[model samples]
Target: MNWRRLQAVMVKELRQMRRDRITLAMIVAIPVMQLLLFGYAINTNLRDLTAGIADQANTAGSRALVMDIVATTVVTPTLAAETPQQLMEAMRRGEISIGIVIPPDFERRRIEGRERVQILVDGSDNAVQSAAAQLAQMPLDAPVRTGPAIERAISVVAFYNPERRSAVNIVPGLIGVILTMTMVLFTGVAIVRERERGNMELLIATPVSSAELMIGKVLPYVAIGLVQTSVVLALGLWLFQVPLNGSVLHVYIAAMLLIVANLTLGLLISTRAQSQFQAMQMTFFIFLPSILLSGFMFPFAGMPRPVQWLAEVLPLTHFLRLIRGVMLRGASLWELWVDVLALLAFTVAMMTLAISRFRKRLD
Candidate 1:
């Protein structure tokens, strides 16, 4: 074992990391930024959302109920549509998520003891729909008295994510983001560092193989990525109350594959880039698409069709599916075979591309 040479390379890499102001900032600054921004800026619950109100009743009781609905912090009456047709058009055009309609016969129906107060809602906006549904269940003026029970012995429970907290969905995806930022950025800098310090030439002159060198460079980051995942899991569990209902080993296995794929991607990027600055820019360029398309901040279903299609190309998309399904849905490997297979394919492709790009002979 050439212990001195290995030690020299390791020390040199560490010194470079410490000396590079941008790298230091990224290592420290990015996480804090993400944590703070995500904590405060990102909210799953809909609040003060606009609703078009069409009140054909125009009666004292109906107006009072409408005013009460607008008074709540969750909803605010915006544009007043003359009819349901106009309100539906507004919802389709993304102008409003919710619309309340009081029919001309609203007071008549209530007087006659008929249940016909219609509430039109756009189910397409899942968050707004959920918030709107809860508001619908609330009676502003008085509860309607039904003559008889429509059914009995029925219990409806929302499954998978019962609380329907967006954090439950977002936390799993954050694991991928952490692994991506750490593994890819570190590995990119590591490979570029070897060449920048003339270590690559020295290594090529020795008996150490390219395969061995690649393995060595990749292992440290893989280990670090695992540590990060563990840290994130702990924080999520204790602070955010995200549950771990599935196999821990399964989470780790999927995580390892994702780390390897990201490391390989970093190595490939480093090989193409001339400097660490370029590598960092390249990483962000990729990171934007990864974060946006992987369904981290928004549901993939809610995104435009073009954006949804773009997200399909990211490895994080599949990994997120595996992690969220396993953790939140308690899905087994058999149920997530497709995602596992996709990740495996991604790992192989990325690693192959990286190894092919790596030059054994210094030039």
Candidate 2:
């Protein structure tokens, strides 16, 4: 209850933190790094995606149509398949995002006033599938504009993100990064700070249980993380005009789960570290992989199989799916329940492990 002592400790900690060149440098450097990485490096555009073509119609007209598809800068034709089964296998193996299946009647149909084309698009890849579908129709749409065309265009419209904008897709992900960085980095170092300051014995003597003490230490950090997340998200929406298609309540709920999962992870790391410096190092080690493999900056599909599988194990992977699904896809909680459940499970298990380790430490 001594205000003077608390204030003295707070000021001393601030001065010492400021005087520590590494901490000061990190505070400034991390933000700059995040800004640069997010601003320039993160692009949602699917570029140079591999495509496969199974051409039953090897006529001149069919070749020209295939050529037009290959010409589109977005899709690169990597494989020529003789059968539909081969095309399906390639797509299943993730070797090609787009597969063009030209039927035997493609050339005959085009010549006989029937420009009907059968396009098989991979729905699993939203962006690449859209791109491929557009390319498939380009050859037909170019030369003809008549009765059914207007009706078809009106019916099967290709509106500019008729659902979600790139900004909306991206900003929600930034929320996850903010929560992860602030909650995990700060709380991970908390107990280590107590140990470094030789206050572990004093804290252990208090009546607070290890779980209660950990919660008390983590709650303030969680609040700070939420505040930062709100500020960044508001800036993204207001300044960039990002759309909010899904329920605001759902976004906030997802944020809460993500914060708890990341905070518990931080608490676990704090329990394992012997000093604040070591905790900070461990935090960075965890932070980099989470950011890189979280599909925040890079497409998870673009990575090698081993790398993609590695990312699947991280909570950030599931959390990113929840954020992007709710914000960009306008998905309901029902659709995102898997990600929500995964995060909830991760939080529970991590918190239990941290609390168990913390109780042992108290003894």
Candidate 3:
């Protein structure tokens, strides 16, 4: 309660903060970054969703219907699929968000006064699904009227997550979010704690190289990551009844790659941080963006193009795709190779950077 003592303590803390550039930068950068990310990147209004068209009708009426959907701007029909199966396959691979299947009888149905077309949406993303449904409900003007009494309507069907259950979509994504949070937090503190305890010098005095030391520290966490992934997957299946349609092995492989990437990123952060607290702060700096910008909460396509590009570089983004593809869509390895390769590249790059930055002797 002494005024002079409180003033002295406050001044001491201010001086300490001034000396830690990383902490100071974080204090200033975090709020500004959050404002920009949430303001510019996060959007609920879905637009330009990649659409696949399976025009089995192959008639003028079907073509006109496709154009009408495109004009709505809710879905862009960029892909032409030869069959309904092909359109569904594109959705499974996350190549397109909407699929329009014009049956061969579509024109005939219109002529007979019972015209209906199917609009399949990737319901894994609830926002996109809702928007697509609204767009589909909008009445379309028939290009060729076979009869004055005939009516045209579009039926919206949700695939992969028919009921539009939030758990069905969110639980698989939680796998990536959980891995990113735990892997980064655990490994971020490891090396800094060792250095703080003066064990780093002892290790350096030994013959172990920097890469060997880094890998040694990271190897144990890989097992921990696998255990965490399995537990989450089991709970999601049991509690949420989330389907695991693809091979479990593919999910395991993708989880392993994602874990390694995040762990290596943690190691890199630990090398830069002078204390465990700084390591934790750096982890938060990475964590916030990973969760917000990585399509965990918001649809990736809904974000601005630059933010979408940023999401593409985050490990969580690719892992989400992999987990969702395997769990919901039953996508095979070949279909998810792009995401796998992205995770692999990130892991290797982060591993190399962490080793190169790790010093044999403590500063």
Candidate 4:
């Protein structure tokens, strides 16, 4: 069986593996990252969901019931309203996932033994809707009693996406996912390939500075990213029937910012990676968390505080909010300035890192 030859070959391979520091690091890092991200960050049991309270009753009983709902920890009331109309508007704007409307006669009806309280849910996000439904059932089976005379009856309503269609929530997120995946991979490989082909040294010998070289590499990808965004949006709208309720200009601006951020990230990775394979591995490492912790597949609020903090730093996390806000809620750029600024900051930071890391001379 040539056992000696096989052992020699195995030893040679292990020596090569040890020399490739990036690959070695990936071997140790990817599994640990997967364990932490999936075990700690990915959660389906939704909690601390943003909710609105429309307390028309304005009575002690209504207030007590709201407190009870909050105590359950299933939803956290963040907005207050005087009527159901306001609550519905909040849900439509993606401000809250759950809305409680205590009618004017709610206290009277409860005392009379026929209390009805409306619970409105944003059905676009299936996970939030499912968790809300389960929580709503808790009060329905046995109403929350504020006093001996008060007994509540819950009427649950699913808004925006009454059908709880997965497509409605996923299509908008897919735009960010596609852009991140394509932009990062394309530019990361492009720069690495240039280095591998000795083109980087040729360019370095010329008058081109590192910053100029980086900009030259990234500029073409910006055009490519825009074309990709347009095609994806067009297809998503036509095939999935994804609604774009906001100004298309906002979407375009957000998309461009997201694209630049990812492209710069690719350039940064390429600067650190010696080979295209290492660049791809780096991209995958970033891409995994982007998909999992960015609230693309799961509810962002469901994750723990530490995990949410990690998510906040991810470019995809902010872009997802921007895309969903514009497409689902008709949110204006002014309303989403925080997310817009986050993306802008990411773009600038990544570009700066890439430029500073890229050396004109080969090591």
Best by lDDT: 3
lDDT measured at residue 196 in model 4 versus the true structure, 0 to 100: 91
Q: Model 2, range 1-363, lDDT digits (tens) per residue?
A: 999999999999999987776566768777776665455444555556776778897877677666655555656788999887787666544456666667787655665555434445444335654565555444443543321231122111222244434565567788988788878888888888888777888877778898898788877776777677679878988997766667778887888888888999999999987668867877886787789778776765545556667677678888777766666546666666777788889888998998898852433
Q: In TM-score terms, which candidate is top?
A: 3
Residue runs of model 2 more than 4 Å from their true location after superposition: 1-166, 360-363
Whole-structure CA lDDT of model 3 = 0.86
- List the pairs of residues colliding in candidate 1: none
For each candidate, the alpha-carbon lDDT, in order, equals 0.70, 0.69, 0.86, 0.84
Q: What lDDT tens digits, residue by residue, belong to model 4 across residues 165-201?
A: 7888998888899999989998888778987998877
**TM-score of decoy 3:** 0.94
Per-candidate TM-score against the hidden true structure: 0.59, 0.62, 0.94, 0.92
Residue-wise lDDT of candidate 3 within 1-363, one digit each (tens)? 999999999999999999999999998999999998889999878888999999898887767666767766778778999898999889999898899888888867776766556888888778778887777656555443333321245778898888889999999899899999999999999889998899888898899998998899889999999999999999999999998999999899989989999999999998999999999999999999999988889878789888899889999999988888888889886798999899889989998999999888777
The parts of candidate 1 lying over 4 Å away from their true place are 1-157
- For candidate 1, what's the RMSD? 12.2
Q: Which regions of candidate 4 deviate over 4 angstroms?
A: 85-93, 112-115, 139-143, 146-152
